[model samples]
Target: MDFFDKAGVMAIGSRLRMLSEQLTEEATKIYDLYDVGLKPKWFPVFYLLSHDESKSITQIATEIGHSHPSVSKIVKEMIKEGILSEHKDKIDGRKNNIRLTPKGKEIAIQIEDQYLDVRNAVEEILNQSTYNMWNALQEFEFLLEQKPLLKRVKALKKNREAQHVQIIPYAPKYKTHFKELNEAWITQHFKMEDTDHKSLDHPEDYILDKGGEILVALYNETPVGVCALIKMDHPEYDFELAKMAVAPEAKGKGIGWILGQATLEKAKSLGAKTVYLESNTVLKPAIHLYHKLGFEKVVGYPTPYERCNIQMAKTL
Candidate 1:
């Protein structure tokens, strides 16, 4: 009776192994549908070949975690079947460089599409909270790739019910809630050393004097989000949209998207031909929601911001 191999632990391990094998079989069937290799064993070879025209047998073996002799055998078979071609490496004449032919490249593209389909299939099966895990994982992965100091960690998305979101126009009475919402947003998501309230305030003043309107989203009668639509005097850009924010407490409820839609409808009702917004990219959820709502990417400000900011425009 080994303590390290207790019955309960062993049973759990065995179950996981069986599940892994089942996933592998299912994956093979998917690949077979695309006329590619039934299993992903060939995927590494395809991926390496697609990235570069040629790779040595040793390089392919190292990448795929296989023995050099085993890779040589596979490469030889592929060459015979016209799936791959071998060339003499110029730097080292002794080594053979492996490359995919046109047919092989076509299969590689199909394999890539199949991978995306699998992802979409899984997302469809999960609840919205679980589905948002994909977005969180993508953001964490992107950060890891860009920065050397960060270690990849699982960051599950915070969840809230969409029905819980409350929408309202900006009111002088709720100025305190509006201020707190903006503070909560910048604090929770982005690290702002100092905020220039003057910039936001100046625009709000000008818009309020003219035809600009604001909306604040509330949850439990507490303000959790804000947005505004300003009627522009300039004919070129008729409406300057501003002051979009979602508080940390009310995040992931899809409130921001609701606010965006509200703003768009407000703009349309006011006869605005176009609407525009300025935002930084660190707010990934906001950016994604904006795109999904039919906003297209456009060059706005001349200077590049540290937060990967971009401007979005849409025609009402």
Candidate 2:
């Protein structure tokens, strides 16, 4: 309690673990009272085998959402207690199949009454509460599965650092940095196509002079990212958000996002209503960021760059 008082909400993990252990201890005691001779931990394997399911350790672990070593330990304990036994699997000689022993089957039948009693008791407990603990746990688990705590913390840290970053209009001084950042990412992940060279080599003539705009992200006065709002000469789109890249040293600092957003705003200021982009699927983070910027994938758009396999567009 003192540790929790000091730790506050950060003690959530420890709190959950403590609750799990407390529940498991209660379940163990209940099983002992029933004299079913079944361990609480063995219930998963026991219940499956009770239903006449002969499964390998892997299969049992998978169905029960546990690791193989965990299931193996329970199986071993049950075997020693003469409640379970195993024989070579018919289809797989390398694997052993586990099933309830005659002793185990008798115990399974005896435990049915206890199972019903426990379920009813738990349901009564739930009825007394405002929220269903089972549903709450599943929802919490799904949230974690969608985005783990680690990623959440990392994103927070990155967001804080990005707050110090300033998105600025590209100048002649940042012309070299603009090319280098884009080159670094492109060459590392893909071969630089001719179109890439034409733009990176001469952004002024290739991008800027064509009524397009370039933007740079300055983090503590250092150029770390660049993006271009290329004025599309086509009728379908007004601007192409292209040549976006963040320096490797500045990765996870959110510079790319800021730079891209700035370029989009710049395009909007220039009377552009729709923006387009092309990318390869292998660049998953880039693709995700594009989607985050409200860009939806579109097909039937031709490209001069051979590396372009996917096209996206957004209406401002």
| lDDT of all predictions | 0.71, 0.89
Model 1 scores worst on lDDT over the 10 consecutive residues at 150-159
Model 1, span 121-235: residue lDDT tens? 8777555464475576678567767863322121212223556667777778766665666656765766543232532445457556678888878777777888877676554
Q: Which stretches of candidate 1 lie over 4 Å from their true place?
A: 1-160, 187-196, 199-204, 300-308
Best by TM-score: 2
TM-score of each: 0.46, 0.72
Best by lDDT: 2
